[model samples]
Target: MELRIGNKFRLGRKIGSGAFGEIYLGTDVQSNEDVAIKFESVKTVHPQLAYESRIYRVLQSGNGIPNMKWYGKFSLKTVLMLADQMINRLEFIHSKSFLHRDIKPDNFLMSKAGKSDFGLARKYRDSSSYRHIPYRENKSLTGTPAYASLNTHLGIEQSRRDDVESLGYILMYFLKGSLPWKGLKAGNKKQKYDKISEKKVSTSIETLCEGHPIEFATYIHYCRSLRFDDKPDYAYLKRLFRDLFIREGFQFDFVFDWTVLKLPAITMPKPSTLCKCTLLILSTF
Candidate 1:
């Protein structure tokens, strides 16, 4: 029951641990650069974690999610830092096609100082979490309870929106630093979630989402969007984020697609990639 940390592949410090395994701050022996090590001890059926990691690869291509390139044989973390760094990564994850089922403070880790990779995250980025359509369509719900959705709590079929609902709770926690709904009591499961549902997301968002309406509204609307058979439209959400910035007179570069930089303004003469992603959702099961 011991881990080999000082192998030839230089290890730095321990950062985090959980039910399945641990994560670490390691330095690639060949390149001598910082990397993350995620070890899976036993078969945990971790579709979400693996799925998230896969999705992170897509986001990493665009520079959206946190960058941890290495998934070695064994690992765990040696440190943690300000929670805000976690939020930044979370925000980037939400921007993609997939929903993050787990967004608690514990799952996030600050990259090495000045190693932020938003630039890589923003590149032609879209949701990579949608890759699970085949798996969850049959009802393989997974996530923590405190941050789970009403449907998820009841063991109903899992959907992308469920991830959004969880994100809403995460945003609330990000803003409030704690969940008020977690402390309350209820008669049954629905009643308990209804209590969480009734909580004002904006009140929490006003403080936590970096004072950005776009981010907060997406988080809140995302909760409402999770309550049905169909998923929310990413393009519409992208548009809404843009409009909110203009109407509210809020100034921030983080305003969803509003930061769209035209590569060439060339006429596609056909549907765009965003259009394809949207179509992919509407047409998918």
Candidate 2:
């Protein structure tokens, strides 16, 4: 069956699905350009689609972040560029008085165009008001258990520091291919999450980064050191990645690991063939 969204894009085969909804490979009918259309039923339980869409709109113009193009997503080498882009994205989010509660490798979709996904994001408050949000213990767990910070698991209100801690785990996961808590067994989901949280808090940074880059451990340490109300030094965190990049003699070109993989033939329409009508409609969508 032929499916269309926002009256301008034709949805093709299903590419993936998550808690929010199903994502389909789609094409801008007029331009014949590829895009990914995510559809969530209006009654979807989480209702993160609208929030995620809004976040994408806010971040579309940010540096190093990806455009809306769904085709040509790429991975990075050494994850330095990835770190830099994510830090920029987070900085922009913070500047807007929002906190990205859910930060994981899955949430960070990389491509030629940058990072894209923000379903679990929420506005902390007005950027003009620098007041700290009080920690609440009654809130339920909100992010991926494996990568979530100890504070998140404890139900303390998440702040910028929690996001930074989550980023550290994600970066380490990218470099190490897996985290130490990947295979913990438990009687139930709650127990499982509790065990994961326990592991995250109990494990030392050195143990987490053992056999991996020392910088990875250091990054985790720095993030975990921040106070609940501390404003993170985003520049310093980014410099850690930059120093790693320099030490490894890697360049900031877009070439990445996925570029080296054997990808299927993707026929992208040339600029000359793209219809302005399609671009206009896509922008609205």
Q: List the candidates' TM-scores in order.
A: 0.35, 0.64
lDDT of 2 by residue, 14-33 (tens): 57766554565666666877
**Which candidate leads in TM-score?**
2
Off by over 4 Å in 1: 1-100, 108-141, 183-222, 226-229, 241-285
Q: Show where candidate 2 strays beyond 4 Å.
A: 1-76, 111-115, 261-285
lDDT by candidate, in order shown: 0.40, 0.63
Flag clash pairs in model 2.
Answer: 66-113, 66-114, 67-113, 73-111, 74-111
Residue 227 miss distance in model 1 (angstroms): 5.9
Q: Give Cα distance to truth, residue 269, candidate 1, Å.
A: 43
